[model samples]
Structures are given as C-alpha cells and as structure tokens.
Target: MRATVNQGPVDIDCRPTLPNITVMLYKDGQQIIPDFDKILPIQKKGFLLNDVSFEDSGIYYCQANNYTRTIILTVQDDSTYLSEPEIQIPSNTHFVLGSPFSLLCMLNISKNMSQSNTKLEWVLPPSAEV
Candidate 1:
C-alpha cells in the first residue's frame, strides 16, 4: 500500500517481513522520498496513521505478491476559491489599539473544518506619530 507524510524524509510503517519495499512521495511535481531512516510498519496489526499535513498530500500505492492497494491524499490550499476564506476577513473579533496585531488565515476547503489547516498572518500597527 502507498503512504505519505508532511514534507520530510520518506517514512514507512509496515511489518519487518513485509519485504523491504520502496515508496515515492511527491509535491507539485517534485519528489521528496528519503533514502534511509524510513519508519517500518509496526510489527503488529491494526496500525494507525497519525499527524497528517498539507505537504503530506499525494497518491500512494503498493504492489506486492502480485496484489495492489492504493492511497490517495488531497492537500487543499488555505485559500481555495471553491469555499470559505472566500472572503479574507475575520468574523467579529477584537483588535488591540497601538499594538502590533495579526490575523489567523484559515483557508477552508470545507465549512466544517478549522485550525489544523490554517496559517498565521501578522499585521503591524501604524507607526506612532511625533
């Protein structure tokens, strides 16, 4: 089976006897598969995939013993035209006076999602007058 992770060395988490396999990771036409130090499949059954991220998005597949399974990952940008973040502004929030401030920009591909996919943006206060 195919697997993926955030931008980093390619990692695998499968069985030791799963027959040392090689997988590929990609992003915007670039490949980021690590040469060594990949996570081996847990020696036990029922493995869980933790910590999913944007750069970790892509397609994965494995062909072993003449059999195959595929995994697909879709990484949505924070500013998708197909959904919210459609308007670039905060919703009824407070701002401090005479202090530097910022907005947390979250481009929601869906209305039901939040935080995990957002990035922070900083805004500086106007300079003090003489």
Candidate 2:
C-alpha cells in the first residue's frame, strides 16, 4: 500500500469477520495506541491513520486471534516524483495457511526523470517466502 504525504484519513481494515473477534494493530512491530490524531481505533476491527506523513510509512500488522495480516505502507513525497505512481495491492493481506501469494510493484515514471536512474525495489521481511 502506498500513499502520498498528507494524503489521508486512510482506513486499514482487518477481514474475515468472526464473532467476538478483537483486532489489534501494530506499526513496525510496535503495538499502536489510538492517539485519535494520528492513530484512531476502528471499533476494534482495525485502525484509521489520519493525516499521513512520511514518518507514517512502515509495516503494519493487523492481528486477530492467532492470525496476522501484514501491510507495507510507503508514503512518498509528492515533490520528489513528477507524478505519483499507481500501486495495486490486495485489500486483505492475510493468506490461508500453506497458500501461495504474490505481490506486485509497478511504477509509471515521468518522462522528465531519467529512466536509467529510477529504480524500484522490494524490501521483504526476513521471514517472507520468495
């Protein structure tokens, strides 16, 4: 997931509604407390990150019961790119156990920027399967 600086009141939802389920959100491995201004709890279902900034860019984990879903949010500065790149990701990052999943990263660089100089990379978690 990618967002421009100051781009939202973005909502990050946790899925597969279960009865009496409680969702907890974590940022960069640290549990996030709802500060209302920055992180807002969404009825124990997920979180809403308000007024996103560059510092908000990080890996978010939505944990419920023993299941966990991971989201990598990249907050880009609009001034750095001629146009913001389009990113597509699954709404639900959680996968069934032993199931295969794929991730895609694509960029639409501006003509003004040198294509040879532009680079796209994926920084995967150490435990991630290739």
Candidate 3:
C-alpha cells in the first residue's frame, strides 16, 4: 500500500473475519497500541492510520488467532509531485433526495510521474452509498 504524507486516516482491513475475533496490529515487529494517536484499532478487525508520514512506512502485521498477514506500506512526501492535482466538478450540480448522481474527476499528472504511480480516488461521505 502506498500513501502520501498527511493524506490519511487510512484503513487497513483484516480479512476472513471470524466469530469473536481479536485483531492485533504491529509495525516493524512492534505492536501498535490503540492509545497512540497515529495508529488505532478498528472494531477489532483492522486498524486506521491517521496523519500518515514517511516514518509510518514499513512492514505491517495483522494477527488474529493463529493467522497472520503482512502488509508493506510506502509513504511518500508531498514533494514527490510537482503540484497538486486539479479537480473540476460540473457547474450548478444538484441532486434530489433518493436520487442518484455521478461525479467526474479530472487529474493532471506531472511529467515525472507515471500513469501507474498517479491515481485519482473519490472519497464519499460516510452516509453515501457505493
């Protein structure tokens, strides 16, 4: 997984949920305590990393019972990009209750960044449906 500095509150999910399971998260072999402001537990099934920075990049371990999974997170500096990407929403957009609407996002990738390295993502409100 790749994230940019200050770009999250990112969630790392533990799959194959089981009954009454407890998940433990670790960074570089050190267990992450929920009380920490940067990384926290999420419903005993995953973790959330907030205010991500380059130091947060490393091997992550998610353990449950006897199963363990490894995740590699790479955090990049904002300077990796020449400039912030631009987003343009249609003018005068409106929607009625219970109606469906679509949004278009346009991004301009810097010449130094490859297509695979540049991604456009939409984060919806918590109440919004996929």
User: Which of the two candidates, 1 or 3, achieves a greater TM-score against the reference?
Assistant: 3
Instruction: Tell me each candidate's TM-score.
Output: 0.30, 0.55, 0.54
Q: Name the better of 2 and 3 by lDDT.
A: 2
Give candidates' CA RMSD values in order. 14.3, 14.9, 12.1
Q: Give per-residue lDDT, candidate 1, residue 118.
A: 52
What tens-digit string does per-residue lDDT give for candidate 1 at 1-130?
Answer: 4443333334333223354544333334554443333322333321233444564566654334444445565545444324444334477767667766665555445465555665545445689431
Give the TM-score comparing model 3 with the true structure, all chains together: 0.54
Candidate 3, poorest ten consecutive residues by summed lDDT: 1-10
lDDT (10s digit) by residue, model 3, range 42-81: 6744788888877888888888889988888887765455
- Candidate 1 Cα errors over 4 Å, as ranges: 1-40, 44-50, 76-130
* Candidate 2 minimal-lDDT segment of 10 residues: 77-86
Candidates sorted by lDDT, descending order?
2, 3, 1
**lDDT of candidate 2 over 76-95, digit per residue (tens):** 65545744556677796887
Supply the TM-score for candidate 2. 0.55
- Candidate 3 lDDT at 37 equals 79
